[model samples]
Target: MKPGIRPAHRPVVFRDKAADLASPTRSTMTGDRTVTWEDGTTYPMADVEISSASHPFHTGTARVLDTVGRVERFERRYGRGEAR
Candidate 1:
């Protein structure tokens, strides 16, 4: 690690509006918004569309999307190609 070469990381708050969650951590990312934590601590706020807290996989809301059916259909349409 080179001194003074790495981007500076400051206290930041990542807010997931959909999940209504806020997390405080250090980051090199910046944002135009500012948010105050419950403890009265203020930090630069970054808005995110999805995070682990709200993502389908993490929240246990993920669906298989009929992958098996799709695969069967594909194989039916394009017979198994001869191994080259």
Candidate 2:
């Protein structure tokens, strides 16, 4: 490792706005806001839009797109033939 070239890494808190969840994790992300965890330790809080709490996969609410039906419709309208 080179000195003075590498950026400093520290612990930061990531807060998911959608899920209204917060967790302490080691990350290089920095934020102006700060929060104290349950242990009474303060760290930088970064607000995020998505997390496992709100994600479809983790919540078992994932939606599947109907691509097969769309393809069939397109083929019926335009015909599946090679164009020169």
* Ten-residue region with minimum lDDT total, candidate 1: 33-42
Candidate 2 residue-wise lDDT, 1-84, digit = tens: 777987678999999999999989998788999999899999999999999999999999999999999999999999998978
The lDDT, on a scale of 0 to 1, for candidate 1 is: 0.92
Top TM-score model: 2
The Cα RMSD of model 2 versus the native structure comes to 1.6
| Candidate 2 global TM-score | 0.88
The positional error of residue 30 in candidate 2, measured at the CA in angstroms, is: 1.3
Per-candidate count of clashing residue pairs (backbone under 3 Å): 0, 0
- Location of the lowest summed lDDT over 10 successive residues in candidate 2: 1-10
lDDT of 2 at 61: 97
TM-score, one value per model: 0.82, 0.88
Error of 1 at 15 (Å): 0.5
